[model samples]
Target: MKNLARTARWLLTLAWQADRARLLKAIVLLTLGYLATPGIALALGAFTDNLLDGRLGATFVIGVLIALVLVAELMMGHFAHLYYYEVGELAESRINSELIRYVNGTPGVEHLDNAKFADTVTLVREEIQKARAYIEALLQVVLLGGQLILTTVILASLEPWLLLLPLGALPPVIMGRYAQRSIDRSRDAAVEQNRLARHLLHVATSSSSAKEARILGAEAALKRRHERSWREATAKLWRGQLAGAALRALGQVTFAAAVCATVYLVLLQAVRGLVTVGDVVLVITLAVQVNAQVAAALSVLSTLHAAGHTLRRLDSLKTWPTREPRTPAAVRPVPARLRHGIRLEAVSFSYPGSDRPVLREVDLDLPAGRTVALVGENGAGKSTLVKLLCGLYEPTAGRILVDGVDLREMPPEEWRSAISTLFQDFARLEFTLRENVGVGDLARMGNDDVLTDVLGRAGAEPIVRRVPGGLDGALGHGYTDGAELSGGQWQTLGLARSALRDQPLMLVLDEPAAALDAAAEHATFEQYAGSAGEVGSNGGVTLFVSHRFSTVRMADRIVVLEGGRVAEIGDHAELLASRGLYADLFELQARSYS
Candidate 1:
């Protein structure tokens, strides 16, 4: 009951915040409409009695009163609906904005690694889509409560025995709450499977995945998997629905039996000359209204129960811990330029809910004003190291010191603002060419000269000339006149975006040229290496990851990672002379080109 009251308060506050005047007007109008049900019953009974007694004038007046009450009952609710509909729409928009802010505004991406958090967020999103229905259900619950109260009083005035009719409503209300819980549980259990099924459907239909599916002849397998997942999800929901239906049926039967007994008792009273024909008519009318009210209440309760669960889930999400607990420390600003550069003092990391560490305790340093390359096999923790340097995740153990200060002491946003990165799987933002590249430095996005310069630096100038409107042209299939690019072209744009940030303190390029051919990749690296002086001018360190030995050879220093630990660190020639793991890999790669 306390939880119910809290949810009710939250819903009412949401409606009030949406539009207080409309909410009040809707309440007044709906109240009058619902209360007219009892008024109509009384007026009809009085009209019947007056006509039977041969009082023509009184009967005519009573008949007119009945018509007015009936008209009000029919029209007021319809008018009230107009006001609340707009209110629901406004409230829904507000909640959606809030949900987006809550998820995206967090500093850490740890929650993205939690499967339970993902499932809950998915359910919350689905629930908020029905925000308008939730508003309607709340209003109905309020109006129905008042109607039921007045109905109980009128039925009791007819006879003490009829009081039991309202009491019979209790079973259905309780049963409905349990039934809704069953349905909610089913939905919770099926969320993962449903998500998988939807993903499979997307893969089967999407243009990007369709080509690969055809090439691999995996279309039939994907179809079978999608069908199986969807079937399993629906089967769980079906079982819950069946159980809920049975429970509701049982409750309705109980109420129906009560209604019949109440009507029969009223008829017996009439036969004993204890009541007039008008009293019998009023009793019968009120009994039917009571039954309808109970049914409506049950439906409203189910809606409220489901909405309450959604609210709870949203609240939990809002409070989910996204960052580790840190002791009180003075916040520090990010440095304008690297002096001693970044030092990883025995740093280690593991993803959330995992026991195996992705990066074991290892010490390393990136000197200021130098270009360093990271060479590793798959699962060698190069990407994880880049994420740590970018302040996307905290180390599970040890500290990363920038100059002499701990990285954790600096504001995450400020620290990240001093860094620029381009990853292997970069976002393909469906916007104009200028907007796509300019988003990397939003403050300078409107500067055409700056956009052109970064595109030149990234060797993407040809792409701009090829498009329809140069920088202003749309760049994806999402638009009517958009120009689509190949994979390599998109990667070039991503590189341009990364280059837009001028002289970042740390420049990270994690497999930035993965989509390009060997010759193109080498050429791109040569261009970037030629421009590395600009980054070096600000004491910035250039860190890049690549499997290509020719590109790796350009770096002043190369660090080879094996099994999440640094295996070699030296210049290209020094490592080659050492004849270690780096030399072996370089020789093997060199032979591949021979």
Candidate 2:
């Protein structure tokens, strides 16, 4: 109960914060709604009395009152809907923006990859819609409660003895609570099942899994799994509907009993000469109006119950931890080149949930204007080491120092601005060719001169020039007029993107030229030599990770790893003379291509 109270309070606070103006308007409309209910009941009661007496003047007045009540009701309903829409849209936008921002900024990358997190994201998306409905429904509940109370007061004043009959219908509201709980339970189950269904659909449609699924003839099996999830979700929904139907029937029975009790009280008053035929007509009219009010209030409760899961999900999003906004650091002019070497001392790291470490006790000294190579077999932690150095990941043990300042202590956003990195599996962003490369440094993204120069340095100028829009040409298979680049061409684009960085202090490439042919690789390395190292004597350090021995041979120094430990570190000739791991691997690669 306490937990529920806390959750309800949180949801109310979120709604309250959404739109103050709309909330205030909605409250005023609800109060008007309450006042209108009594007028409507009184008008009906007066019409019944005048009809019994056959009074034409009273009938004319009743007719005018009815028209006024109808007009006011229509206007209130219109403004209430308008107010709800304005408030609902505001709440939905606020919640969704916060959800997306928090998901993007959350610390652990693992959380972003999990099944539960994916389901939560999907539920949050659905919750935005539900949240909109919830606010409107909640406001309706308030209006319904107010109207119900007003109608009851009007009926009680007309005949005190008749009020208990309608009060006896209170047990039906208890039934409405049971209905709500049942619906809420099913809704939560449906959300979970829908998540599973989506995951199954992804597995069946994924490009990488398609070929295997066909070879194994597993399409039918996957379809069956999807259907099973759907069935489970639907079954829960059907059960809830059955329970709601049963409870609604019970409410109808209670309503019938209230009508019988009201008639008996009216007869008793008539027998004692306490009420005239005209007064009896008025009493019956009020009783019927009260019944309808009770029914409307109960129905609102039912609707709220059905939407409880959505409210809970929306509340969860509103409660998600927000990233604290800190004042920006005082901007100091950074030098064009690194003043000192970048050092990694006894650094070790492993990805979340993995028992085996990717890099252990790895130490490196990369001085400014030098070219360094990381050589190892696949999974030798080459890529992980680059990510750590580039400030994407912090080392589990030890520290990275830049000009003797610990990298961990620096703002990660500020640290990242000083380096450019292209991973082995860099994203093929679906955007214009210029936008794709220009995104490396968003501040300089629209500078056409810089974009052209960077593309020229990466040997991608010819590719861009051939496109219809040149720099503006869209790239990807996802849209009309989208041009697909070959693997080697994409690598060049990645290189161009790195080149766009504003005075990058270090350039880190993980298997950068893996797709280029031997001759293309040679030419690419030659171009890299002039553009990568010091133009005169002071430039950013360039670090390369590759499986290709030919590519590693171009580096000034190659560091070889064997089982997460450095096996050898020396220049190409020195390692070859020593006949160590680097020498053996290079000879084997050379023999394969001979």
Candidate 3:
């Protein structure tokens, strides 16, 4: 009951904010609708009594009362449905907005990356609509319970033996509670399976894996796996429901027998001259309504139980902590510019729940006015190091400092604004060209002059020109007037977006041009190099991560990573002179072209 109250209070508050006027109106209409059932029953009984007495005036009066009650019931029922649905939709829309805002703006990338969090989000998305129906569900409970109460009182006035009809409701109430617990457990199991099934569906249908699956003839296997997962998830739920249905049937039979017995006693009273014909009709009519109201109340309680699961999931989302302690031990603001530069002192990191550290005891320095490049084999932790620099993930051991201040001191958004990055697997958003580029800095997204400059700097100008609408053209092939950009084209657009950051203190470009042709790649690097040199020659740092020696050679310094440790750090000339791992990798790459 405590849990139920909490869920009810939460939904009521959400609905009240969604539309105050509509929700209040719905409550009034609910009362009117429930009143109709007993009103019609009583009016009919009185009208029947008048007809039997053969009094023309009394019969006419009772006839008018019955007609008025029926018409009012119908009108109340119609408007109640309209208001209830409208308010429900409004509540749903408001929740969707909140959900999106929380998911996107919530600090730290862990919630977005972790599997459990992802599954929770999926369940919330699926079941949030159930919460939107809370107002109607609550009203149904009260309306039905009130009908049962009023029916019991009316029947008791006719004959006290009719009070026995309401007592049979206890058995159904107990059964409903049992069914609710079983259903909640089943839903928990199903949510886990649903996440797995959705993953399989994505693998089967996603464009990235479609070709590979078809080539390997793995589509059949994927379909079978999906079916198996769904079966496992839903099997227990279905069995429990079937058992619940049987129990419900048994309970209803018991109540029906009770109803019949009550009417039999009432009829016996009329035959004994203890009551009139109208009294028998009222007792019988109210007895059936009591049974229906009991069933309706039970149903509403069960519905609320199911919705409680979704409400709990939504509540969990709000309180889920990010990777960092949300509140800082000592909060400090980041400066607009760095003077002594960023330092990583004995930093190490591992993914959440993993034993193997991706970066082990790494030490590095990015002094304010230099272009540094990181060269490493796959899995050497170059990307992980970059994430640390960007504060995407915190170090498992050691600490990072920026000009003597702890990296954790700075707010994430402020730190993010100070740096521009182009990750290897950057998102290809299907927005208009202007919107895509504008995302780099929303404040300046509409600045046409800046947009044109960034595009030109990233070598994305020609790509934009190829489309008929230029920067106004929609990206992606799925929508009308949307052009499917080539791999290099998309890469350059990502570059353009990264470059949109104005006078950022740090620039990190990870594999800046993997898809471009050799000539285009070299041209972009040289152009970007020139731009980065100007930015970093001041109190700014530019870092690049790539296997391309041509681009790495342009950096003022190169750091070679091997086995998650810095194997060597020097300029191109100095590293080649030492003929260590950097020289070996550079030479190997140089031989590939020859």
Candidate 4:
């Protein structure tokens, strides 16, 4: 009962916030409509009794009153619907906006790794889509309560024994609560499978994967998997629906039996001459209204229960702690320039929901203003290390120090603002070319001179010349006149975006040139290496990861990682002379090109 009250308050608050004037108007209309039910019955009974006695004047007045009540009973609810419908739509939009802000404004990305969080988000999204139905159910429940009260009073006035008719509604209310619980459980259990089915459907129909599916001849296989998942989800829901229907039928049967007994008692009273004909008519009509009210109550309660469940999930999501909350007073400011390099001491990390550490305890330093290259096999934690440097995740053990200060002491947003990065898997935003590249530094996005300079530095001038509107042209295939560039061209644009951050304290490029040709890759690396002095002047560090030995040799120092541990660190000439793991790998790669 407490939970019900809380949910009712929450729903009312949402409606009030959406549109106060409309909500008031709707309430007024709905009240008049629902209360008119009992009024109509009373007027009809009075009119019947008057006509039977042949009182022409009283009969005419009573007949007119009955007609007026009937019109209000039929017309008011429909008019109320127009106002509430708009209220529901506006409430839904507000909730959706809140959801978007919560998901995007979180400080860390760790919560995104949990599958349960994803499922809850999916459910909340689905529930908010039914906002219209929820609002309607809420209003009906309110009006119906008043109607039921008026009905009980009329029944009791005719005969005190008829008051027992309203009690019959209890069984159905109980059954409805139990039925809703079963349905909720079924939906929870089927959420994962339903999500999988949706993913499969998207894959089957998406244009991006069309060519690959045709080439691999996997269309039939995808179809079969989608059908299987959809069937499983559908079967679970159907079972729940069947169980709920059966329970509701049983409850309604009990109520129906009670209604017949009440009517019979009223008829017996009339035969006994204990009550007038008008009393008999009023009792019979009120009994029928009680039965209808109980059924409507069950439906309204079901919708409210479902909406309450959704609200609880949303509340949980809002309170989830994604990262340790820090106060501004506790956070240190980022240094304007790096006087010393970054140091990693005994640092290690493991991803969420995993026991195995991706990066084992290791020590390293990147001196201010020098270029450093990282080389390793696929699972050597190169990308993880880069993410750490960018403050995406905190280390599970030990700490990272920047210029003699603990990295954790500085604000994450401030620290990240001082860094620039270009990863192999980068976003291809389907917007204007300028917008795509300008997102790197929003403050300077509209400065054409800055954009042109960055594009030239990244060797993307040829792409700019090819596109119809240069920086202003739309990009990607989403637009009618959009230009879709080759993979290498897109990578060049990503580089240009990264370059927009001028003199960042840390510049990280993780396989940034993988899509470019051998000559282009070499030229790009040479240009960056030549500009190392300018980057180093402000004590900035330029760290890059590459597979090509030719580009790796250009860095001032190289670090070799193996099995999640640092194996070697030296300049190219020194490593070749030491003839360690680095030399063997370089020699092997050189032979491949020979």
Candidate 5:
């Protein structure tokens, strides 16, 4: 009974925010149909008694009335079910779609990286279906509750002594509901644990870590850890289900005993000459009807118990603030070149949860058509700076300006649309050859000539030539007959994908290729240098990051970053002559190659 109360409270609260008119109309229709159930049952029972008394005329009249009531009940019930279903679907879809939009439009990428936010993502995916089911179940409970009250009231009037029947059965119901409370909490916790366990298992089994796991013989250890989590979750789930079932059985037994006692009481009343045999018949019929109604109500209660837990999970989404649609701002077009240069002045930034800043008091300027390469060892704040330039991250305490306009005030999306980027770990979309390159320019995606042209420019023509189906060839690791490209080949295709974008003003290639041979790497650099300064009717200022000195040498200038600041900025020979950090790193790489 406690669980029922809790579920009822949740249902009322959830519906309170919905369209009240629709909810009220649905309830009224359901109540009318429910109210007619006992009258139909009583009239039929009276008709039986009347027939036994040779009152054919009264029996016939009651039979016709019962027929009319049945038709009305059926019509009302059908339309009520439709309204409830539609309302539940609308609530679920609207709530979930809004949550999705908010997540997608959130300002920073770090929102997805937070553990608690990740947990919410998992919960939302799992609970959307459950929440919809809960709403439907809630309506069922409402309908059944109305039926129970109406039937119980009629049964009490028919035989006043039978009032104790339902009341006597209440204790076991209360116990069952208490058991449900524990079960619901445990079930929710188990689901969360299972999600984390599954994520761990996926990471452990990935091909990227497979070789290391095999050499270290960590497979057995990983399997054992997975098994431990599985066992813990399953144990909790089974315990909850078993306890709930036991309590439910106890309730059923109590209800059965009441039915037996009520029958005996009616028979005794008939024998005492206080009631007719027909009256006793009516009491017995009404008792059976009441039991059926109560059973149905209990069934609805059980469903709500399970659904209530799921609804609570979804209610968390309602608390999340809604996202307003982004109104497109008036954005100035990119200049033919970075004439006045791009500038980051007094820039300061830190990662989502870190106390220490990744970039501090940093300043940079890249003039028109100049290739600026950033050189840094791993974790020297290279990628963070790239994200800042790409508009993926905003400075915590500074300004980025393009032609003296603060980038923060300018439309970030417009700036992003004007740049092409190839990250160190670029995605390999599982699609056809055309789509692989065409995604760069969505407007020209299916243009065969444009795709071919970009493939040639990015040096991915060799891959296209080798595939059996040419531009139509399937590519991915997932397909059975899928042709997987070598690391160098994949890098070339990624570059081609970037090149397919129609005339972006700035290009970013972060560690574009670290897998190619020395000669191929040199050739790639030559292609990059040649692409700058309005080359081949296409134009862009290229900003690249590379660990290889051979690749860095092709840039018009190099900026050496140390301790979150630019330590040196000059052309290759100029920096080499200075014998600073760049010269030292260049010597180290050159000697290693020798």
Candidate 6:
């Protein structure tokens, strides 16, 4: 109950914040319409009595007045719908914006890929239009109740027994509530299935997956799986619909019987001369309209219940499980300069939902103004270590320290602001070349001189000379006449983007030259190392990962990682003299070159 109240409060607040004027206009018009409904039956009765009494003038006036009332009702209804549409559009925009901000703002990318979160978001989005009118739904129910009351009063005035209209209307509302519960249960399962089916269809059709799918001859298999998913999902929903139909049929039978009983009782009253012919006509008209009004009011409840499922989803979005936010006590002011250096003491980590650790206990120090290279075969935890340094993930067992303070004592945002990174899977953003390079460091993004120097350092000068628009050309095939680069060219642009941050405290390059030829790779890494070492007194530490031993030899120190442990750490000559894993790997590469 408390949760429902909280959700209602949230939706009400969201609606008011989105647009108040339009909301007020719609509700007022709708109320007036509801207030005018019972009056129409009264007007009809008045017209009948005047004619029966042989007062033709009175009859004519009432007839004209009835026509005017109907026209007024029609006008109010028209304006109400118009205002609802406007309010709906604005509310959808506001809701989507807020949802995106909160979801993306949560620390890290884990929850973004969570299936439950995806399902909830998709369902809420599908019902987005109805969800926006939460406050209006409450107001509608109240106004509908008012219409029912006014309708009951008329039926009672003719004969006290006519109040049975409400009782007869009760069964349909009860049955509808049952149907909605079944639908809600079925809908949850259906939504999950639908998402999976849609994903299969996308994988089969999307260009990114086409090569692999065709190579594996899985196109027909994918189609069959999608069809099965669709059939299963729809089948459950169809059963719910079947149940609802059954309920509606039972309700309709009771409704028809109520109408027959009301007619019989009114005729008996007329034979006894207890009520006039006008009163009989009024009772019959009020009964039908009143029944319709009850159904309308109940239908609002059914709609609200349907929308309530989506409202719950919206609430879940706000409560998604996430990494704990840094507490005030845990945050310490970062120093203006790197003091002793950054150290990882007994650090170990495991990804979420995994039992095995990716990185084991290991101690390493990156002194100020030094270049450190990390080299390891696949799954040796080199990239994981870099992720830890970049604050993308925290160690599960031990912690890292900056100078002498715990790294956690500084805020993650502060830590990130002082560093730049180029990951192996660097994003090929579908933007202009300038935007792609400048996006790495937004503060200096507009400075063309900074972009030029960074591009030179990244060996992207050749790419610039090849393109007609130079830095201004659109950088991907997704845009009109966009310039698509070779893999090496894309790597060059990525390196330039990372280098745009003029003086980050730390620079991490994870295979930054993976696609470059041997000579180009050597030149890029030399520039990266030399430039990082020139930061003077507060020079940042540069860390890079590479499989090429020739390039790795350029680092001031090389750390060889093996099976999630640092197996050897020394300069190129020292590690070679030690005759360990690093020496063997280096010798193997040298032989290939010879």
Global lDDT scores for all candidate models: 0.87, 0.74, 0.81, 0.87, 0.75, 0.82
Model 1 deviation from native, Cα RMSD in Å:
2.4
How many residue pairs clash in each candidate at the backbone level? 0, 0, 0, 0, 0, 0
Instruction: Give the alpha carbon lDDT tens digit for every residue of 1-594 in model 6.
Output: 354455556656766777888878988898888777788888888899999999999999999988988998889878987886677678788878867876777646656557778788888777776754555565666688788888888888787888886788878777877777887888887998888898999899877697799999999999999999999999989998888778866876787788789989998999999988887878888888867876776677667677677667776888887778888988887766776778999999887667898889979988878899999889999988998888777788898888778987788778888888999988888788889999998888888899999998787888888876987878767756788788788888999999887677889999998888888889878888866678364668899899999998989999999999999999999999999999999999999999
Q: Which stretches of candidate 2 lie over 4 Å from their true place?
A: 1-38, 60-68, 71-75, 106-110, 113-118, 159-193, 202-221, 229-337, 353-358, 375-378, 432-434, 462-492, 513-532, 536-539, 560-568, 571-594
The reply for model 4, stretches above 4 Å from the true place, is: 47-75, 275-281, 327-329, 459-474, 477-490, 526-537, 584-594
- CA lDDT for candidate 2: 0.74
TM-score of 2: 0.77
lDDT of 2 at 18: 87
Residue 18 error for model 3, in Å? 0.6
Candidates ranked, most accurate by TM-score first: 1, 3, 4, 6, 2, 5
Q: Higher-lDDT candidate among 3 and 4?
A: 4
Instruction: Report the alpha-carbon TM-score of model 3 versus the true structure.
Output: 0.90
lDDT of 5 by residue, 311-417 (tens): 55455544444323345573445455455668889888887668799888888887656688999777778888888888777788788887777765656667777
lDDT accuracy of residue 471 in candidate 4: 91
* Candidate topping TM-score: 1
The TM-score values for the models, in the order shown, are 0.93, 0.77, 0.90, 0.89, 0.74, 0.85
After superposition, the stretches of candidate 3 with alpha carbons farther than 4 Å from their true spots are 55-68, 101-105, 243-254, 323-329, 466-469, 477-481, 535-538, 577-579
Q: List the residue pairs that clash in candidate 4.
A: none
RMSD of each: 2.4, 5.1, 2.9, 3.1, 6.1, 3.8
Tens-digit lDDT string for candidate 1 (1-594): 677778788788998999999988888889899989888888888988988999999999988888888888778888889888888888888888878877776777777788988888888888887777788888988888888889788888878777788889888887887888888889888999999999999999988899999999999999999999999999999988888988888888899899899889989989998888998889888889888998998997788788899889888888888775545576777888878888999889999999899889879999887789999888999988888888888899989999989998888888878888998779998899989999999998999999999899788988999889999998988766698898899999999999889788888888989999988888878766634446347788888899999998989889999888888899999999999999999999889989
lDDT score of residue 150 within candidate 2: 69
